[model samples]
Target: MQDVRVIPPYPEANEDGIREGKSKSSKFSFNFNLKPKEVKAHLDKYVIKQDDAKKTLAIAICDHYNHVAECIKREREQGDSKSDSDEEYTKQNVLLIGPTGVGKTYLIKTLAKLIGVPFVKADATKFSETGYVGGNVEDIIRDLVTEAEGNVDVAKYGMVFIDEIDKIASAANLIGKDVSGRGVQTGLL
Candidate 1:
C-alpha cells in the first residue's frame, strides 16, 4: 500500500520547519516497502540468542493483525453495523510463575523488544501487607508509566512480571508461623 502526503497548511515557515520541499510532519510518518519476514530476518542479524522468544512475539503480532483483519472483514460483511471489542473474542491474560533466573524476566523483555511493546518487572517483595513499611503498590504502576518510552505505550497496554511471590507468604509470619513446617505447604499452595 502507498501513502500520499497531503500536508496541512502552515501559517509560518522557517528553515527548521520546512526545509527544501518537505515539511516536518513527514518525519513522524514512515513508509516501507518490505515484507515482515524480511524485517525479522534483518533483526536476527543483530539480536543473538532468544530466537524462540522472538518468534513467539512475531506470532503474537501476527495474531493481532489477524484480529484486525477479522474486524475489517466483519465490517465489510455488516456494512454500517459493527461490533466493538467487547462483542468480539478477547485475548487471554497470562500469569507466568517459575524459579529464579529461569528466563521469566528475559522472556517478557525479549517479547517486548521483538514486538516493540512496553514492559515492567516488579518484585512482589516490594509490596507489604497491611502495616508493612515501604513504597505504595500504586507506585509500581506509576514507576512503569514514568519508565515507558518509544513507539510502545506499554504502560497503557503491556505486560508485568511479579517476582518472588513466595516471599509474600513467608514474610506473613511474625514469629511462630514457620516452626511447625506448615508454612511451606501454606506457601507452595
Candidate 2:
C-alpha cells in the first residue's frame, strides 16, 4: 500500500509548526485547536477599544467553530449512521449592541475575514413583517446561500450579522404586540 498521511483537522498555529492543546500546565484550555489569545490579537490589528467585546467574541467564535469542527471529525470517523440524540449542538448567536458607527459590523466583518469564513450582513430595519411588501428576514439566509454558491450546508455554517437589531424592540407606548417587529424577530428565531 502507498504511504498515506493523515492531516489534522486544524492547522498548526503560527510559523513554529507547534500545535497547541489543553494542558494542566497552561492557564486556559485552548479548545478546538484554537488559542483565544491569538484570536484576540488578530482582532486587535483591525479594531481599537472594545477589549471586552473582542475577548468575548473571540472565545465564543473559537468555541462555536471548534464544536463544529469536532462534529465534522466525529461524523467522518464514525461514518454516516449517526442517530439524533436528546441533546444537540447549539449555536452561540451574538447580539451586538452599540450606537451607530461603533464598528459593530466592522468587528464581525474583520473576525470573519480573519477566520476565512463567508460573512453576511443585513440590516434588521430593512426586513418587513411577513405578508408585507418589503424584504424578508429569510433573505439573510438566502444571501448566505448565495455567498456559499447555493450550498445549503456551507451556508448554514457561516455567520450572518444582522445589524440594528435593537430597532425591533417593542415600543413602550404601543398597547398591543408590534406585529411587524415581532414577526421579523420570530422569523429570525
Candidate 3:
C-alpha cells in the first residue's frame, strides 16, 4: 500500500492575500526611461483635445523624473557617500490652475498611470489646519505612503493631485475670519 498527498489548486498567499511576500505596490516599476514625446503620445490615447496642456505637462514631468533617476544613479556610483560639497537639484513642483472640468486632474492621473507610479488625488477643501477635525496637508503625504504600501521611497516620487486648491483662499466678504481656509493655506506653505 502507498500513501499520497494532494496539493491545493489555488496558489498560497499571506494573510493579506498577497502572494510571495511581495507588496502589491511593488508590481508597478517606475519608467525612468520615458521621453517627453512618448509621454504626450500616451496621454493622447486617454485625453481628448488640449495639446498645449499635454505638451507642457509631459515635458515637465519627464524632466522631473529624469532628475530623480539621475540622482539615484549618481548616489550609487558614489557608493552612497556624500561629497564635501555637492549641489543637489530641487524637485520642481508644477501647479495646474484652471476652471473645473478642464482636465487638470485627468492630465496628472494619466501621466501617473503612464509612468507606472502610484497616484493619490485629494481635495484641498477637505483639509483643515492642524488640531482641527478635518485632515491636514501632511496627511497627503501619509496617503501617498499608504498607496505605496508603506514604501517611503516609492511614495516620495508618487504624484499627488490636490484639487480645488483655490478654495483655500480667504474670503473677502466674510464677516469673521476664515480659519480653515486661511489656516490650510498657511499649513501648505
Name the Cα RMSD for model 2: 10.2
Query: What are the TM-scores, per candidate, against the unseen true structure?
Result: 0.45, 0.74, 0.74
Question: Which candidate do you rate higher for TM-score, 2 or 3?
Answer: 3
Error of 2 at 57 (Å): 0.4
Sort the predicted structures by lDDT, highest score first.
3, 2, 1
Candidates ranked by TM-score: 3, 2, 1
Query: Native-vs-model 1 lDDT?
Result: 0.45
Which candidate should be chosen as best, given lDDT against the real structure?
Answer: 3
Best by TM-score: 3
In candidate 3, stretches whose alpha carbon ends up further than 4 angstroms from where it belongs are 1-31, 80-90, 171-177
For model 1, state the Cα shift of residue 89 in Å. 2.7
Model 2 over residues 1-189: C-alpha lDDT tens digits?
Answer: 222222231233323222222222332212235567877887887789999889989988887877766665566678652336415756677778788888889988877665544579998888888778778988898898787556555455668898878888666577765655877888888
Error of 1 at 22 (Å): 17
Candidate 3 pairs with clashing backbones: none
Tell me the tens digit of each residue's lDDT in model 3 across 1-189. Answer: 121111111113322211112354443223266677877887887889989888889889878888766655667677653443336655567788778898988899877766555689999999987887888899988988887677765667778998888778787676765657988888877
